[model samples]
Target: MQSCELSVIKYILFTFNLVFAISGIGLIVAGALVLSDVGEFDHFMEGRILAPPVVLIVAGCIVFLVASLGCYGAIRESYYMLMAFALCLLIILIIELAVGIAAAVYKNDFQMTMKDLMKSSMQRFENSKGDRTAWNNIQTKLKCCGVEGPTDWPENTRPVTCCHATREGSPPPEAHHCRSAAPQDGILYMDGCFYQLQEKAESASKILIGVGIGIAFVEVIGIILACWLASAIKNKGD
Candidate 1:
């Protein structure tokens, strides 16, 4: 390749690395926020749900480090460093591709698994303080009452968090007002937490998968540029 061509590739690789480094830092922050927000309930999170954020954090760190390698290699025109950077990109690309495929394939099953987990968690709500707090948080956030529905709660009693009216308005006329003493008219959110939780998880999973695929594509380009530049440098030396 001509000197001008190599210069263009070098700049392009540097630009790509800069963007990826920024993205890696963003991902690390996002993952940390998520882990922090989970708070005391992190212990309750199923392995599948908990794994993603942790993976994001780890991946972010790796990406940040690899990006540095790429940036330095491109700027310094170091053939060995460029080859190492390309190898790292290839490895990251493969791992991300595999994770994306697995997430896509198991998306539906993940929902069902979450539903079952919620039901099980609800069973322990009365006995476990952590579980109770987690359930309350979920109900409040999702505007839902129980795992199955309002009926899942003890008769004539419901959490105050579940009393708020949805955007559609107050409960139907036949439904009991939350403050009322009538057992016949139950005052609780009519919806179940399961569906809301499932939907949220699915949406998040889709976003993650999309981002992973996009990053993988970028990694491929980075790998190619690094390897080509390394080859060009080696040939020029000969």
Candidate 2:
């Protein structure tokens, strides 16, 4: 019975390690993609948003290494390797917990930081080609005019991209023509981009925090099983 139990425990640990290894690889790939394209937005965002992807890549590499150690220890029933694997898992769990807590506590501050960044980008929208292009793309995609409203633009002269009739092709009866000399309230987009960007950032942060916590929980389970199996092997040998 003891032998059978040990086999079952080892199998479970092995399967968990394999699954975690695959997950780690997925994270690494995702993070790499983000990091590769991050340069495009660096001018506008100032590389502030790059931290999360970098963190993911680092954590993923660590997770992959720990998973390898766990798998090898389980398969070979190596006591030392199991101990090392458990130690790594504990360290990762603590780090993840700290990250999750920090994210939650600083959630509002992060949003404000992003908001300020976007505001600054908006202030320099016309001066920098990259900023203008970024703002135009954002406005076109989000159907938003400026950081706050159409009035946020200099002299209340909204961009052609903000003209709904120009972009949407179906202007309301009250909508004014974009080429008109006077600024028309009905012509430009009514909504602002700041809140939309903030909401998206917050949602993404929540998902990341949730994933981190879930992974930490799984790591704890893996650590316990690995330590238990190592102890069982030691006692059996004795």
TM-score of each: 0.80, 0.82
Model 2, residue 39: what's the lDDT?
Answer: 35
Best by TM-score: 2
How many Å off is the CA of 181 in candidate 1?
8.0
Q: What's the C-alpha lDDT at position 32 in model 1?
A: 68
lDDT of 1 by residue, 1-238 (tens): 4788788888988999999898788767766665555432443346776666678788889999999999999999999999999999888777777766776687677667776777677677668887778877887777787776766766544556666644467543332455343334444567887776656555556656666666777788888889988988887778
- lDDT (CA) per prediction: 0.73, 0.73
Tens digits of per-residue lDDT, candidate 2, 75-142, equal 99888899999999998888777766766677677667766887788777667887788887877777
| Residue pair clashes in candidate 2 | none
Task: Tell me model 1's lDDT, rounded to 2 decimals.
Answer: 0.73
